[model samples]
Target: MSKDSIINNLFRVASNMFTQFNTEEPLISEKTKVILKTTEGRKELYKKIISNPIPF
Candidate 1:
């Protein structure tokens, strides 16, 4: 999948999780960090993947 798609999916998943939890402290502390880290990781991965182009 493309970098944009992966980032979009990450946001979707985070939103769904937050909706399900509906808590305050957990949302601010734990879940937020998790989502942020996941996004950052995806970005790094996307950069690496894109930098090294594959032949079809």
Candidate 2:
């Protein structure tokens, strides 16, 4: 899958998990926004992906 597809799938799963758990944390939304950010946040995500090396 492409990176965008992976990210979208991740958001979908996270949303489902939150609903299942009845979580009302604002931090989750805030973190999602940060992940979607256009600048430094994107760089941070890139760094994390490079370091972790997701196995497909």
Give RMSD to native, each candidate: 7.8, 3.7
The digit string of per-residue lDDT tens for model 1 on 1-56 reads 77769766866786687778756556545654564468576676568767997999
Give me candidate 1's TM-score against the actual structure.
0.41
Model 1 clash pairs are none
Residue 52 of model 1, lDDT score: 100
> In order, what lDDT does every prediction score?
0.67, 0.64
What does candidate 2's lDDT look like per residue over 1-56, in tens digits? 76555565766786677677754564367766767655566556656776998688
Looking at model 1, residue 20 earns an lDDT score of 85
Cα misplacement distance, residue 17 of candidate 2 (Å)? 1.0
Off by over 4 Å in 1: 25-56
| Clash count, one per candidate | 0, 0
